[model samples]
Target: MSAPEGPTFRELAVQALSSVQHGYDLLAPKFDHTGYRTPASVLDSVTGALRGLGPFGSGLDVCCGTGAGMGVLRQVCRERITGVDFSAGMLAEGRARTPVAPDAPRTDWVRADVRALPFGPVFDLAVSFGAFGHFLPRELPGLFAQVHSVLRPGGTFAFPIGAPARPGSRHYWELLAFDTAMRVRNALWRPRFVMYYRTFRLAEVREELLRAGFEVELRALEELGRRADGSPRCRLVVATRPV
Candidate 1:
């Protein structure tokens, strides 16, 4: 609920006023301490969901912030793993914290935009976490296309999507408030930040993935339990490029 331990409101305001890359760079040192970092539970669930599909040769963590998703890739990818982020600050922290294993898959940190990936069809698997909110809905097609381009035929791109907030729940209002604030900030600021909590809906996401030439499937992460309606609390959207 509270902002990360360090960085007061004024400091965060200053950071937010900057470009997204610069803001994250400034926040990198304390980024993991904040609740903004994807939780371990979500990461674990994604890892489990990808296990049966894998024994994959290479993996990429797109928009990898501080490399949490890279940790998951390390387990499933046998040969090499790459973490790419436009934020050098975040990538630096990721490079430092990521553990190295003897004879394990090699890891590389690259700086690139997801909408315009720099790699060819080289990766067997690609995953992203907690980074989609940074992209506008209009950007989804190109973003997914770029990821699709970098994967070999039959390769997969995976990421988790949580259920929408219930109408009357506190989380609903909290998200609404955050989005409203972001809109206000963008209106008043230059080089606006693109994070909008509600923009990435499941249906629209699936449509975009399909348009990008991926055959998409949703696998409910049962380990996260279910909502009152019996629907999964979260699902891993696995989109595979046709071979």
Candidate 2:
């Protein structure tokens, strides 16, 4: 269910019709109220997971929409934190929502496409949340390459991914219907809005990350619990640039 303060159906419809960047810009104000924003529970779980591996220095949040990942970076990173995305509106909201405390690390926001990050090997850690659905499977190689390029040798790139919905489940059908609708909408629309729930699978993603020269590890987010088959319902993908 959507939050009472979240966007109305009409607002969501308008956003769905716009390009990804523009749609996010239009949705930025009400984004945190929507179910689209990463949940606090997930953020806290990630913080707990990364805390064990970290005490990292500078950190980056890729495709940071309204600063959810920035909050995670704040706890894990000691030196500085940067949030990057193509949407100015979303960045503005992020900045407003996440004010820098006197003792907090220096925070910066950069406007650029993640496909070609403008930084060198600078960050010690990086994290992203709920944003991977925008990229097609074929783009994973280049996307992971870009992420790999921006991290210092031995720096970590981490993100959470949910297990695929079980076949015939309500969630499975919901996701299938959503992707189908998006495909149809894109075929008929001018500026295509790209977002699909089913495209990012772990096996294909692991291969791409390996091809991009990162040592990969999977840690179950036990806080999220397990499936009936005893597999983790959510797992953290930890990819580290080689030292």
Candidate 3:
């Protein structure tokens, strides 16, 4: 499913007017059809990169909207895989679509905020995709700490970060305009829906990961190709909890 089958403009407008949680709830059923779901190519690229880094035992996907990251976990993890999200509607969609078969490793769905992950040092690997923009930069220290707390010693936390949109490019201006509108809407609105395209800079994220006690390394996801200057289009950040 793609844009042609996705929500209408009016439907999207109603969703944008709603609170974040409620908005996703309204969007969940049609999410797979929307452009918002991370592309399978990106997921495949990350999974390929993580394969060399793991034979991870148990995996967790934080903010696992509709379980897009679950297939990645299924490929790498040996024992169990879980996806956690605050949106019950998203979780329900994920559950309905989860491709578990007889003898497959257990897949669990938990509804919880990623800022306050609900587990101990049990998972051997954790991942998140396309969700960080929802978090304020100030929330990252605590958020990274929470992810750190949930990983077993030496466990990996990985996610993909794309290069910032080029200045003066159509993409850049589009994001700037969208963010401007969102800021104005939030200022005038009741329930603030936090989503920003330009907030999660790689440098700041790396610093916060270090502060959270992660040993961070970044590897290019070459499958996504490189930019004009030869920089990777996307880099996968692999942060490991200390042994």
* TM-score top scorer: 2
- Ranking of models by lDDT: 2, 3, 1
lDDT of 2 by residue, 60-123 (tens): 9999989999999999999999999999999999999887589899999999999999999999
Write one digit per residue (lDDT tens) for candidate 3, span 1-243. Answer: 357878888889898998899999999999999888999999999999989988899999999999999989999998999999999999999999998588667999999998888798999999999999899899999999999999999999999999999999999999899889989999999788888988999999999999999999999999999999999999999999999
lDDT top scorer: 2
Q: How much is the lDDT of residue 102 in candidate 3?
A: 80
Evaluated at residue 186, the lDDT of candidate 3 is: 95
Task: Report how far residue 111 has shifted in candidate 2, in Å.
Answer: 0.6
> Each candidate's TM vs. the true structure?
0.97, 0.99, 0.98
Candidate 1, residue 98: CA error in Å? 1.8
lDDT of 1 at 47: 91
lDDT of each: 0.92, 0.95, 0.94
- What would you estimate as the lDDT of candidate 3? 0.94
